[model samples]
Target: MQTITLDALIPREDFNILSSTGSSSNTRNKQTLSIEDLKYDSFFFSALRKPIFQRETNEWDAEKVCSMIESFVNDELVPAIILWRNQGGYIFVIDGAHRLSSLGAWINDDYGDGPISISFYGNYISDEQRKAAEKTRQLVNQKIGSFKEIEAISRNRISTENDLKNDIAKNLGALAIQLQWVDGNAAKAEDSFLKINQSATKISEAELELIKNREHSYAIAARAIVRAGKGYKYWSAYSITEQEHIVELSKKIHQLMFGIGNINMDDINSLPIGGPLNSSLTLDVVTQTVRICNGLDRKTKTNVGDANEVITYLRNTLRILQYINSKEKFSLGVHPFVYFYSGIGKHKIGSYYGFLMFAKELIEKKKIDNFIQVRSRFESVIYQYNFLVQQIIRKDRQSKRAYVSIKDYYVLLMEIILENPTYSNEAIVEEIKKNDKFKYLQTEIVDNETVAVKSNFSRGKKQQIKMETFVESLPRCPICGGYICSNSVSVDHIQRKQDGGTNAVENGQITHLYCNTTYKN
Candidate 1:
């Protein structure tokens, strides 16, 4: 990973713009700065820090960042860049890390989508993020032009190309941004960051919680995993050997979740575990890890009170996910049910949490073997009844019931698997209706109309139809229980035909031909 000095990243302007000349104490009272001040004031730029709790750079898209620049050029109601003064004369960004970073990115040409962000965050950006950045770069370029292009124009204005310079002067040159400084000490600064960010931030509550818990092993591991070891080194304080372990395990999980795209960007063909590559899934994965390993109740908040325990939990969580994704061990067919699936259709966080809870139950209750034994049959049901399965997942997912609702459904899934019966869609729906927790969800409507709208059931049915093409596109295999690469599958008699078994539906089973002849025979 490359570490860059602030000076190396900072761009210099042609004119020498110094900090306000006054008594040091008196100058400290000024709480505002213009774009020119940000550009010229060495101390102002030098003292800026994107707080630890601040979001990753990629959280804001290029267009959003560019909008801020556009707003600056347009001189609109741009918000103040909140700052906190340190013990010396240093400054820390409290509530405007994204705004500040965007300006810095524009100045430094390090829009979290490119090699600059990769290098800045120690070379850990995902392909998804790089693509996003590339798009941002295009948008920024198309909308506002690159910094170099504008700078060149700015430079040439003093020479013969005065017309071009004058045309862009307002858009590129003559604008100022307001800065607001927080009063009090470092604690107050942190408090201000939290309070101000509560309303201004785009980060979710769970993600903020993870940022707040950064010191914990799970948080560090999650940060490492989410960025695919491309972001800031949260585990830097550990011993080199421990750091290696963290890196190795995090890489293993990262690859399992995201593939080796960070290492070999070109080979990335399939979507990652978190569809569309939402970094917030890292928080969910971390939370589930801690909750499962510690055997904590689902309703309780997962915390960082125990670092060692958290590390162990993450390891266990990685192990389970690895097993689920493994080709050899417990090949779960169509296991995307475990993660959020927002491709052509809608899937929810409940799908992600539900899988975690299911895995936890399997691990804790020593039901792995039972799950494996019935896995083939269970997967058949899930494959055939994909619509109802998603409907059940969606019904419970409303009002943020992912963490709780998944467990209820997982229990139902286990029961269905254990019973070894042909579960019709109606039967499944009936069972879901009987579920005390799902009763209210059974007859719910999910629209924002003034009066009662169509039921969520109707919506899910339509969604289910939309999803049919996708589901049919998936390779169906009952033996190995995943997408089949083989051109043909063998249907064999459960009771051998030689034993006078009738050709009944109950007597037929699907299996890989290799399994039917080579193994079963």
Candidate 2:
């Protein structure tokens, strides 16, 4: 990802131009400034944030400024303020982040003494130096402090020392608290913040997802589900984005079906198991969970208990492992599983599994890139797997002893993964050739036998034995239970009249040709 240019990202310049005398020269003087102009200093704040400041931002204490700005940003009663320009585009505060975001609950009453009665707590300081700094702040705030230089910045933004309160509520629109430092400057600030602020930690995407939880109740519910569960973190999942994708998938499915504004906790029970969570193969577990939790006999009204959570989590985990460790030919390694499972609902289950496995093997064996191969192979396998699955489903529906040829297995043999993933004709024959049943059923071409046996790399074209006809029935004719179906079942040319069959019961009596000829002699 390339950095967005500052000029490109934030364009409209409607702020007072900086005069040479270190003051804002109000340029828009066509008419007297309205109360709207003074009501909130949007232009003034904008002027305070000119990009010129970002040029030499590193020379200043960015951490201290960012921290102070964070404070002003948090306080609600405080109006939009800026760290205004000096000469040129030297910038400062744009607006109160806290106040603009609506962080104040209420202003103090007039009868509550001259000072505003507000509830506020200072930083989570944990050192003597910080304590002394707090002491300095108190001294300045009480007008008896040594560090009076920051008195202007420290005047409680809201009034009772509270012009603004910085908690969770503030007029975010009026306060629109955006730090207008340059991208490069922001990077510098970030680097400095990391170096100087030893205790301050940056927000991670996981924590960010948690913080932004309220924005999307669907995500909130998914995060809550993961949080509520124990002994399982999404660390094993493909990626954080993939984990988020699962939540989004469920949210999308619900939105698509019911047009629900958000995912309902009760209705979420209907989600496809692992359908939302698994990063590879099928979301069988997700579907199953939704099925079990929402199915008629289930009881979602009683909050999904601990048992269900563990069962569901483990079920999905094991299913994913199964999807990974499937088929002797290939393994769907960690990386590709994440990539392929994103839009797998549109592909055939077996094909998805096979393609993932093939891609993983391809990455390791062929030394290919996982990202590109995943997408490219995914497209390739869709139609092939789709056809393979269609053939399987069709056979399954027909309820016949589905006969598949070994010649046909290569198409779907990327891997024989999943719970009974239907095999193609060639795959079935290969599987049967590997089978110990009817040892004579194989063609031992390489081994110099009539029938051959399968090799290690059956999926790849290596020298091999191929299975001929399906010899699923018993050795003897199942009906008569007397003669071997293998040889006794000779083609008794139906046109017996054409041959000089003596018109006698003995000649007419049907039997194995070998049995009949010897008996006549």
Candidate 3:
């Protein structure tokens, strides 16, 4: 074996006065590369192996990888791959994908267009299928080639790979190979790998996941949650952003439940089965439930085979919180309901759950110390739970509205909370006032001191304003901007119907017929 350039198999410097006395040996026609230095017996798999990215491979992808390698071996060019060394002893693939992929295929026994060697599968063939198999071999002999002839046919390979188990053992005995293999530091290797792959440009989910990592902030823990869930990929695949939301949510859940600054999957796996599946309030409930469980040092317990118990508690909690958020529908910002996701981080479940502790203390008041025990007892866990809570809430809210994208909403909420945690209602009102949607809010009461109009309410008959006049007077729909069909002059509940909304003037809103339909949906 020797390191050499592709231009010349035997580099002039390493060229030797070789003996080619055998009649069958070719002195001038043998394929040899210009080698800088040669060690004829040094060629081995370990010398060519490089650690890149420690990719976690499952059966499905493992199958695909084997197939990919088989395909590569059939072709001539070898594209580079990125490799990295993970905590695991295995070498991570960074680059030279085509080459190493072929290697994997060889190891997997997916060679010569057939899969072999690997175990875990049951019986290789059944008596019932033997006839079909025999027929296939007979056809290969007549149409393609005899198994022996096919085995000996000139292989279309630039790089040859084989093992003792393969039928091509005889061919391996006669082959001579000349090539160069280069390895570099893992980080630099990946950079080079990326440069090589940049040309081919296949965008992969793994890459997208890495992109979301943002230099591996708390995001790494979050990504880990999603990664674990990939084992259950039967669920819809979320976009990179939504995936991050799930991760962030996991982080929040860990934070709040145990006041844990980090997230742990062991805690998350305790949530109910349908918890992650639900896109609605189920996520929020699951998050809180997981937090509560983590708060109890549940992570240390090995008996948590199922999260059903904790999930049920979570549902109860959501049922309670829903009533509260419903009564005081506070819009943290645009898209009203989205406002609450940030609140999870604003205060722990204990803080909000204090309303209960209050009653327990003295029918209406829980002391600050009692609240602290509820909160600070699991301070680290609390952050984890809150992280999960906000994450689910984020995904739910984000899916409904792209108006305020995830990044924008997250940044804005964080900024506002950090800048002024105790922003007065008046201050919130002022900010609310700044929204373009609120500009149309009714001005004020008609003053009793007004010179002419003295009636407290419209009296006697309806003020006979003309249909055209009223039509011209009304504002356009703030939502859809169609003519607020003055014909249907009654106000509409701006919030919505299913939410137990009503058509009272205060609760109602002015909107054109067409716009109302759009808004209703």
Candidate 4:
């Protein structure tokens, strides 16, 4: 659906405000507010806060946001915003968060890249997010005049030839949005929020779990890693020492998984997690990674533990990521391009989890050396017949289903290759078919039938061509003979430095971290 983010337009506040003093006896507040009330400096605007449990206000696209603004400006029958005044006198939006946030975004000109978002996210915004913000800004400015321009025109401080804009400016002050209030305690308001939001857009199970258990260790750790410990501090309630520990560990893991910039068609040399960073998906991945690393079942709902548990989860997750692709001594430096990406350059989430499971097994069983001995040949087989990965993922689109099969596939493939390192691609395929579980996987055969060709290539085809070229040109690690990229590169001394290896170029060789540090010695 290509949603645009307006999450930062409204700040999130905890709904646990019943304990605070100065409770508002009145159930309802104001009935309506004019466009002026939405201005950044307006008192009414300053009091508006979204509940912490509310989903991010990013479901609307640029067109939808702009349309809402246009409808408001045209005085259409927009729905009333439902709100609750907490005991602390803070006005919480029980419903219509996106609606109010969209209006505030227009008035403040902060679709997401504005000062509010930068400050809220602690200036860790990604290029993808910035680009989306710029696009929303451009679209809004083009379709409807900017709020500033319209305001200036209303005050006769500027002139424009467009008659429609002048009319909008003239009527802007008189536009007032209807407001509805929710009565009762914090629990009631929260209930109302869940009911309204669930009935409307329908929250995903993952998101609902996160919202319900926002303070859980897994949720805290996931949020920390997803935003690289820069966005809203979900763990702020922890002690300073614990918070610092959480940030340090989360940042390290974040760098390990997403240190490489956003993946694009032009650059196929290396990838961190095999795809662009998506907020929801990345959050889910981080949550899953934490659970799996901690030996927690995927379907189990864990309790909201203390900060120590959260830190432990983060540390365990970090260890797994380092083992996957890092410069650590014990790291296998598993190449993402080989294991996580599909034959046609698509990032396979199933393959990613499969590798995680495989890596965890190797670490647990102390079979890293065994795998390393057959790694080069194993990768060659996987690369030669990468279509199997595509078929497995396509067959089982769900990650849980695909991950187990892919992990088993890796284990079986490695067993066959270790049994006979000299096996050809066809020989390996024949051997793999012996396992009834993988019998459905077959090598692709070309039709060779003449068909009409398009003058232009599809984006996927272009990306595939680029990926092929990039893979063909990649440098192999001298020690492990596996592909190496910027993320996993380490320089080794042919003559051990302890044995008096000099700084001369002849003494140096490029190798994977594990190869140089552990395997070679």
| Highest lDDT scorer | 4
Off by over 4 Å in 1: 1-43, 158-165, 169-174, 260-269, 278-290, 297-307, 327-334, 337-343, 380-401, 428-467, 478-521
lDDT of 4 at 383: 83
C-alpha lDDT (0 to 100) for residue 79 of candidate 3 = 40
**C-alpha lDDT of all candidate models, in order:** 0.55, 0.28, 0.30, 0.79
Between candidates 1 and 4, the lDDT winner: 4
Model 3 scores a C-alpha lDDT of 0.30
Query: For model 2, how does the per-residue alpha-carbon lDDT over 201-246 read when each residue is reduced to its tens digit?
Result: 3333323322322223222233323212211222223355544444
The sequence of per-residue lDDT tens digits that candidate 4 reaches over residues 282-374 is 656776777767777657768987999999999988998888888787777777887778657667777787788788888898888778877
Residue 344 lDDT (model 3): 16
Best by TM-score: 4
Write model 3 residue lDDT over 89-154, tens digit each, in one string.
Answer: 223334443444334333322321222211111222222123322433343333323323324443
lDDT of 1 by residue, 1-521 (tens): 11112211322111112244322242445556655545423556765556655554445555577797667655677787777655555566676666666676666666654445555556566555556556666776777667667776667654324444345554555666777778776667777777787776555766676666666655666666655544456666667776667667667666666553332211112434443344434455545544554455435665553435535755876766654453333333234532345323433555655666677677678676566555555555445544444566666545655555666665676576567456664565466667676565343334566786566657655655655554455554444454432223566687888899889999887654444554455
Lowest summed lDDT window (length 10), candidate 4: 274-283
Rate residue 85 of model 2 by lDDT: 32
Evaluation by lDDT, superior candidate among 2 and 4: 4
Would you list the rank order by TM-score, best first? 4, 1, 3, 2
Candidate 4 wrong stretches, greater than 4 Å: 1-3, 18-23, 299-301, 343-345, 394-400, 445-454, 495-502
Full candidate order by lDDT, most accurate first: 4, 1, 3, 2
